[model samples]
Target: MMVRTVLLAGCVSFFWTGPVQAGMPSVSLDLTDIAQLRLQSISFFLMVLLLSALILKLCWNLLAKDFPKLPRISYKGALGVSVLWGLMFLFVLTMISGARELLTPGAWEKSGRTYRLVEDKQPDDASLAAETTLDERRRKLGELRSALFMHVATHQGKFPGKADETTFAKEFWLQPGPLQARYGYVAGDKQADPSEPLAFEQAIYGDDQQLILFTDGAIKVLPTTKAQDVLNGK
Candidate 1:
């Protein structure tokens, strides 16, 4: 009856811990991390083996005292039993680890000294399209800035006072997509402060950020309110 009880307890413990251990996803590790993990596992196994041996020995002593007719188990036999228990524990751990890797799709990453799930950071189709459109707008603004500088060089250091696309060469003015609105140009000459706002998008882009150009020929993506404040000379 006592032997049956011990076996039942062991089975219960295994089932209770198995799923918890198996749920941990496998992680990618370098040589150093692998070595450390192995060392820790060995240490844990040895500790469990020692504790199992001590418990078995204590049980044997109690049984021998309480019931002398009971068959005696030697120290070597107890140690052998502990070894078997330890091996079973390690086997369960190995099975759980293998099951985790089989069930999960991605490898976890090592962050500092710990492991974390690797997240999918690839942008979705809409995000990609938005980014591509933003890039096109930036390129157009760059061309417009170059044209403005060229106009200043030829027209006595003065920018076009009018915001019309015809104020410069026809090819220089490109309409932005989705909104099809022309860039809002501010009247500024070459002699104005280099940091002064010269041009901006007529519409706000994604995340309330707008593309703005300065008299210094610098372009930036800024918040709509802040860009407005700069344009207002605030």
Candidate 2:
């Protein structure tokens, strides 16, 4: 009975905790595409650390029972530990460098945008900085969109009748999703053009449904059927 109770408690805790990420769609940052690259870099480094630790732990478990108290650990064991440590240190250093670069004006902003306005310009530190500014603007736009969505829900008792970059930037900067112009919502016939990737939805992020736009120009629909497994992406 005690074992069963503990199991039930564990299950409950696992199923009900943390941020309410339920019914949230996975939004891919498409604008700059560089943000995706940055994410990939971070993800790969984390994977290396996690995989190394898991392999080392398993090896230690398997070898511990067979080996007696030894004066020295194997070279392979030391190498494995060193590799993990080195990867972690490298990741930290990379993050510090990236943060420094982003702190510069227009560097972080250039990260997210649908198109590069400076395609003709030669690639340089300044050009890259400009791209970062665009990226930051895009993110701010997304935040503002989300906030406007909630406001529309609260005051109007529904989503906005129409959404544009201008109206959002003008109002609710102090409230949710406040930023410079970035997010865009098209309504009616404007969204009817199938040649374009656009949709007029009552809400971008909803209780039962969440809409996510990827830089790849794909829209993903995420359902919150099981709240515990929400937003993880199938």
lDDT of 1 by residue, 110-201 (tens): 68865577888987544543554678888989998988888778878777776663356765564455444577877644454656788887
Model 1 ranges off by over 4 Å: 1-132, 165-167, 188-192
At residue 127, give the lDDT of candidate 1.
51
Candidate 1 TM-score to native: 0.41
Task: Report the number of the highest-lDDT candidate.
Answer: 1
TM per candidate comes to 0.41, 0.22
Model 2 residue runs over 4 Å out of place are: 1-31, 68-84, 87-234
**Top candidate by TM-score:** 1
List RMSD in Å for every model shown.
21.2, 31.8
TM-score of 2: 0.22
Q: Candidate 2: deviation at residue 49, Å?
A: 1.0
- lDDT score, candidate 2, position 98: 73
Candidate 2, poorest ten consecutive residues by summed lDDT: 174-183
